[model samples]
Target: MSEHIIVRVAGVVEETAHVRTLRLEKLDGAPFTRFRSGAHIDVVGPTGVLRQYSLASSPLESSSITIAVKLEPEGRGGSAAMHEVKVGDHLKIGKPRNLLSIADDADQHLLVAGGIGVTPLLAMAYELYTWGADFELHYFTRSREEMAFAELLSERVEFRDRVHLHVGVPRDQQPEILEGIAGRLTSASHVYTCGPVGFMDQVRAVLAPTVGDDHVHIEHFEAAEIDTSGDSTFTVELDTGESYEVPADKSILAVLEENGIEVFKSCEEGVCGSCVSGLLEGTAEHRDNCLTESDRADQIALCVSRAASDRLVIELY
Candidate 1:
């Protein structure tokens, strides 16, 4: 479990039209924050709702932590609430969890980011540059005006020849550009991508022919949309020989909570992949966006997914 801390919103910088970066520091003036590249902290909102945001600052900074948030009107109000927070306001947040940590001892690294997906990659770029490693960043945005952190990144002493930008007008050339960047994949190289499902899907498709699937990494801010019209009430069998009924109208997470069976959760919208439990038996109706096809075969996220069969046996972590 991550330690929850109270933090003060020290600053907020508007990076683009809809994107803003929040600079947070310890409320008590203690430098206790610690996190790695690609880690994200869960911020507790005014409504007592927790939303996950990736840390956009390098680990080299301990005085404060930085996160970039893009306003999504359709979202669950995390970004909107964050935008409404004034500087010097106090907010509670969870310790960082890193589901997208960088690999070690790679000959070279390739980072492909689309739109606001560049937040995590920004931290990785800084870390890679600090280590004097071989890496390149390819950023895709709708337009120059929509580009976040452009000025900050361009001013970096370490990024003189390490960055490339693409405007999204002619998306027809994206495949070719990605293919050209991928070129011939080497065993010592690794590729990481953070973007929309379609963009990441294309990246995987174009690069998989040359690069091994294991060499390519990805993270999703939102889960892929899945249909649930066929959902029905089902049963869940626990390791302790206990069983519970899950109604079609209620999620597994909700039912478990009703029974006092606690589970860790954040961003209950099914994107964070935090409540994924091991599937022991029965099929799952995968409604989450982050799980891969292969992941779906072995695990189920209790927050959104439910039993596809009459009953499901699972291992809770």
Candidate 2:
């Protein structure tokens, strides 16, 4: 029942320095389906790398889908390959999946985006604007030159003044800005954030005292790097009464896939919770940034997390 499909790259637009907007056209005969704001699609590439990029375009326009990718110098081949993609290139894409979605009952929305993390937030801004909903977008970057979609975002009526730009400042200088604007966020207003790990961490630290845990939503383009160097092997038990040994150097998801378990996953770095499953037993050494501490005790993300014990069991739904 997976909605995964292969699509052709229809076009590419240079959005800014080190950033390109990829336009994908569906090959299915049923035409393109709609995705809500804050939804992301996984693109499978060569070398078995599965990367997740948020859809930046509005869902109302279903003829095509767009994702903004920022080239990282130290990144693995994913971003580099995406940057070199040409028209007519075929890519495997998963259906739009959303973990950070806009709440319908929210009275107002506060969106904070950093660098390329602005991709999903931009879609949310569009959704709010189309509905004439109350919202504010705070975008932060190292410099104006690095910001994407400057022209389009600035031209929109709802985003022009409400969009606050923060650039060229030390880390200490950012706290005041975050506290000044985001201090009033309440249960009635949900705060959504996406960006580099440090950026998201700073935002979380600033708002942790003011906003409740349920009111904050975040998405990461890459998984958090964790030190998995250890000497151990764990047993992963599937729901079908099958078990496999996962080496310490590899992830549980990798072992399962090698054994033909066919689990749905994207963003193997653990940023996306697509590989999360119920933990039948054993303590998990949670290294992912996607789930909270409380959530880790009950469920585990097989992509990045490993077991703290010799034997761990998981039930895939």
Q: Write candidate 2's Cα lDDT for 92-120 as tens digits.
A: 88888887788888878889998889999
Full-model lDDT for every candidate: 0.83, 0.83
lDDT for model 2 comes to 0.83
Candidate 2 scores a C-alpha RMSD against the true structure in Å of: 2.4
The alpha-carbon deviation from the true structure for residue 276 of candidate 1, after best TM-score superposition, in angstroms, is 1.8
Candidate 2 least-lDDT 10 residues = 222-231
Q: Pull out the clashing pairs in model 2.
A: none
Per-residue lDDT of candidate 1, residues 1-317 (tens digit): 24688899999999998999999999877875567787777888776767788888878888888988889899778778888888999999888877677788678888899898999888888899888898999999999999999888789775658989988646667999988887745767788888888888888888766667877778778766767677789999887888999987889989988999988888776777778888989988788866667888888899998876999998888
Identify the leading candidate in terms of TM-score: 1
Q: What's the C-alpha lDDT at position 46 in model 1?
A: 71
Candidate 1's C-alpha runs over 4 A off are: 1-3, 292-297
